[model samples]
Target: MSWSMSLTSFPSRIQTHPTIHLLRPIKPTISSPPKFPNLPTIRSVQGNFDHSPITPAKTRWETMLETAASLYPLYVTAGAVVACLKPSTFAWFVKRGPASYSLSLGFIMLAMGLTLELRDLLNLFVQRPFSILFGCAAQYTIMPAFGAIISKSLGLSPALSVGLILLGCCPGGTASNVVTLIARGDVPLSIVMTVCTTLGAVFLTPLLTKILAGTYVPVDAVKLSISTLQVVVAPILLGSYLQRTFPAAVKFVLPSAPLFAVLASSLLACSVFSENVVRFKSSIIGASLASDLSPVLCAKAILSGELGVIILSVFLLHFAGFFVGYLSAAIGGFREPQRRAISIEVGMQNSSLGVVLATSHFTSPMVAVPPAMSAVIMNIMGSSLGFFWRFINPSDSKDSPKVDDK
Candidate 1:
């Protein structure tokens, strides 16, 4: 009652006397802060992301393709050059007689000669001698048999028949070593087998040819032996010696050897082609005879219409060699790599050598046909087979036993 009355009185008084006092303002102070109930705590940052690199495994097919692609241009160029070379350019070389041919042959032999030391041979012996031996035996046995049978059945001219047999009698090629490496086979073993067979063939090739081809051609064993010694053995010995005595020179030579070999082979091919061009032309013309034609026409037919049959047989023989080599190694308890080496060594033949001999000695284009065809066919077939083995038998390649190079 007093407060209300006082306010009213104050209002009346203020109205009456228009003067009043003002009150001062006071500040308030805070006591404590509130906290969040469920907030998460912060952690340290992660280190920089990893940036390590990775590598992929290489494959046999990749190797084969790479090597083949690299070599194919050289092969084509060599073939083209040989085919186009003026006959007159080579005529002088040929007319200069057997001596020039012998010299060229000698060069080939020297080029082929491997610079394998005693240690390499010892390594081969300790690692896989049996596998090597079996491969060699299978190569010699099956190939010559196949060749003889095919040649006889085809009723080819005697010179041609003998030529086929000689082709069979020859050793596995140095090229096989390269192919084996591409296939991821045992390269060292392949080299050993190639070298061994080549060296052995110095004597065995002539003996085998004389025995098998005596009826078909005048295989003068004595003269042939001398020719082989002059053309093959002497040069090989010289080359091997040079490689051993002059290692630096060999380093330079080795890189160019394949190219030189190709050139020499192309020249040899040209020489053969020029001489046999007429015969090959005639054979092509003659091959068109129908199966039911007269005997006279059949006889006139080059390779006796048996060319097809012989080709088929040779294809079979090649496959057989591959199989035999592989199986033999497997049976002998060899590891995967050695088996692969054996298979390759058994399958590939030195057809170039055969072509050279056929051209030099037989002088028949028909005789040269088998080796010429073989040179082309084997590469195609071998490469295809290698692809299959790599794709289908990959585990066999990697997990199978290995021969220690050491």
Candidate 2:
């Protein structure tokens, strides 16, 4: 957010002094640590003045792109509807199977990595190891446990239960970083928490899912671990490596990365929904017909059945995660912003990872549904919570940089 004057280009027809070409390349400076420093890392280095000044036209285009990328929840919801009504619309993506799922999800991880600096991740951990570790531990323990309880209490089907549990066992989502910014929370902590939990998920996700979901169905922990390594860890590390190794190229592509992630996540979720459309339809139809009622009442009856159960179970899982995550953070004596960051991080799972994992390792399509629904539901919830926090805490409305001081 800082700027420095530098020499600029002239018309080729004009001769320039030798000193004119010696202008130094500007390094972008972040405003402050927790005020979403990395956010602009993915955006253009507008401060780099060795080139032509930014045009209003280009700024408008970039704004349009950013707006499209930020409406992630709407995109996911619309994709789900389209998939349900016209399954064939997403058949191409589904027909490709694991290859498709892995690629889509992997790209998202890569994009996230590009937005990071490995050194920053390390600095954050060194600065606040306890806060980050506590959040990560809660992420693994609280959600998975609550997921199991909710599924059982709701009396969901075996496959649906595994889906909910798997969703919980996964890591904090990238969307949480963005939500934290909106909530005026500790953006730096949110980013670090997401990265740590995602990387840790290579081990924890498989182990936890195997333990909690094992009751509903057999789980091969080894296979789950391998799948996670391939689909999650590898892509993220590769992206980080590329960012460090090729800074110029990374900068060039950074603006497009977020849009790509948004599209890929939306497409992947909808494809899964389309792939499992038959099961969804059958479940709904059967549930609707359970009362043996007239066709006019079938629509309402559907919500009272298996589909309803899955929806309710998934909703309860996230709701409890948000509430419990906050309560735990407050009890730990963390400040307000840190609590918001932890709450959002814990409440929103990497549902895309869950969808990919379920499809790759589990035979049941129903096992993928809860995560698919989560893709639609969690964003709405996260955004609403962010708005609520931002408005209620007037003193914290602007992202305060004091997050790192603690």
Clashes of each: 0, 0
User: Model 2, poorest ten-residue lDDT window?
Assistant: 1-10
TM-score of 2: 0.81
Name model 2 segments beyond 4 Å from true: 1-58, 282-299, 394-406
lDDT of each: 0.61, 0.80
- 249-352 in candidate 2: lDDT tens per residue? 98778767888898899898888878777767887767566758667567667767677777788888899889999889878867677888899999999999
On residues 283-371, what C-alpha lDDT tens digit does candidate 1 reach at each position?
Answer: 54565455345666654564544545445555765776677778777776666766777888888777666766666666555676666
Please report how far candidate 2 places residue 228 from its true position, in Å: 1.1
Q: Which pairs clash in the backbone of model 1? A: none
Clash pairs of candidate 2?
Answer: none
